[model samples]
Target: MSTLDQSRYLATPIPGPRSQELIDRKAAAVSRGIGNTMPVYAARAFGGIVEDVDGNRLIDLGSGIAVTTIGNSSPRVVDAVRRQAAEFTHTCFMITPYEGYVAVAEHLNRLTPGTGEKRSALFNSGSEAVENAIKIARSYTGKSAVVSFDHAYHGRTNLTMALTAKSMPYKHGFGPFAPEIYRAPLSYPFRDGEFGKEIATDGALAAKRALTVIDKQVGADNLAAVLIEPIQGEGGFIVPADGFLPALQGWCRDNNVVFIADEVQTGFARTGAMFACEHEGIEPDLIVTAKGIADGLPLSAVTGRAEIMDAPHVSGLGGTYGGNPIACAAALATIETIEADGLVERAREIETLMKDRLGRLQAEDDRIGDVRGRGAMIAMEFVKPGTLEPDAELTRALCAGCHAAGVIVLSCGTFGNVVRFLPPLTISDDLLVEGLDVLELVLKDL
Candidate 1:
């Protein structure tokens, strides 16, 4: 829907005149808690590029933190939203009910990774879905304790703050977090290498290490859920070791624990698979999805086993704007576009291209500690030239250089040493390679 060209073009400097003016106003008006990665304010966006207020067509590698998977202003989503708004925006799905909400729940139940009888409840965001899932697990199993892994980024809510691993920025001084939330070790191959070779190679061993701690600290009998991101997002694009996810799922199955996959960042074909759990053949009892569900619209869901989801009583799970009609319409259209466009396969192709490119770069540079992730959701972890020590300096420099060159790259990780790349699946081959070209130049300069 953008009028500007699809490729990268900078008519002015990164922030430009108008963006600088907006930035000045934002500082005066907006809260400091919210931050933006791209320096310029967006005027329009389509496919893989964002046109800033100063008439700069910049490559959007971040994809609005993996939210705009189907692409910004997708025609299908736009038309659906327009049509739904023309009729009515909301009648409260909880009070009056609507076909759109039911249809979305049906789609999630069918498409999610499982053949069991399933049900879904829609929410306004990933955080809400997560909190509700935990509540459902507790109600069904009558357990109060929960286990979360290291390097997990759930959300900013009070309960999720305790669930998250990072301290500063996400959970700094968020005093006296929720009770009975426990932290466990993750199967981080790159970091585990420094611990021991056997642990690095065998994911089951790492799971055992965590499970033992869980047994001693939080006892599986009292545990309500084992919530985790299949691929850790804000902590870094960390893909666990080979058997990591499956091992944890197996233990959760043996116990009465609800294994919840927080697929907020990795769902909706953002990863090569339709869902990241499919890659490892791990079926979660409950799956929390958002970010990419309705193109750019705000919608989220907690889909799970029917018995588990049905545990809550009537009037238990909902909000004023949960499953808004407009967002539901947008979600249905987004799924249609994804299926019709063969985006899942496109993600695999992107993985082949990006991993191959970054793999070669890693071979050449010692500072590039690891290049990991699935589909278009790839990341590079920076470290000291000859050691495992995190090099956050290099990561920040790389991000700044990319922004200066009109390519929007994002930084992440607990140690602040990861540079993630999440280009829209609809991006042209030439444009994708051109973005990589910008990244290479940034690396070379750094």
Candidate 2:
């Protein structure tokens, strides 16, 4: 619906009658376990705007948590899905293979951060890719221990819950988690206090600190892999210290522990590069990618060194609908659109625009503890005006205010005091600034 107006419009109050009715239905029919960030219900989305069921055109700063980098219902992706579904929806790649799956794999193998021979296996979601990556790492290294960092957000599965660091919603009572998953300290420049300044300059110090713990607690011989998000998503868009990643990769290489970059949130040009690892010039032995891979389709891949990826035996690394033909076609079109539209560079432009605006806001607002992140994945951590103590109240208030004003924003951070922005790369500069304007007004009112 290119003819559809792609700008913000408010036809009714936030969560008007229709939306509230739907919400009532959802409350009765849906599981309470699934949480919602907004009271508004999406009816249609295009470009930078999500038209809610109440006909309120809200600016989409969350991009479905960076899933719609190419924008919601992208033309190329839609066309590809339509063609693929008409021909064949699913035949189960493992049972009866198809070229779309192979093409998608080739694209991932070539796009993911790395050089030399690489292999790829697709899955339905980020959790599946991560679980399989762990399986492959263990198969290759013959180790049982995996190193996950603090402020990390992996997924919801049992094994991923063990790999993830947050409690409360993610891990609270979901205990008895998978064994052998160890947690390490991350190079959080904003929250590390004294070490924050040190790590900013020499991130290796932070890396060394975590490495020492791993070496002492979980010996290198027993370590299968070190999993981390280059630029964490749900865990507050925390970008690790500059040299921190290289040091970790080096140690993993030295100790023969597989280095896996969980780029699920930072992949596919979301971080101004094809992958966030490129910013550090670090080529992870294995990289897990999803989210923005196929526009908005469910697709994920674990692409890595050929030797490591091929370690698993036949039929050991796939799912029934892992590389469904429809998803693969969408992925191919998504890549083509990314390349043809130059969305990678567009992500860089969005970065410059957002950081410039938010940098000005942060300078005047002491409550904004820190402003950090790369590309469209930027975040502002909120804290007490004069101290480092997190201000979760203000964070929640700001998000609520934005939502009421028809701007879709999301919050994160271990303390729930970070407001993150993940607007689609296709958003026009005017629409983005309008969204930011709402945020500024909301913050001031708060």
List TM-score per model, in order: 0.99, 0.99
Model 1 RMSD, rounded to 1 decimal:
0.8
Candidate 1 lDDT, 1-446, residue by residue in tens: 65658889989988899999999999999999988877899989999999899999999888898989989999999999999999999999978999999999999998899899999999999888899999999988999998999999999999989999999998998768999899999989999999899999898898889899899998888999999999999989888888988999999999999999999999999999889999999889999999999998899999999999999899888899999999999999999998999999999999999999999999999999999999989999999999999999989989999999999989999999999999999888889999999999889988
lDDT of 2: 0.92
Q: Find the number of clashing residue pairs for candidate 1.
A: 1
Q: Any runs in candidate 2 off by more than 4 Å, and if so which?
A: none
**Candidate 1, residue 426: CA error in Å?**
0.4
Clashing pairs in 1: 235-413
Steric clashes per prediction = 1, 0
Over 4 Å off, model 1: none
RMSD of 2: 0.9
Please report, in order, the local distance difference test score of every candidate based on alpha carbons: 0.93, 0.92
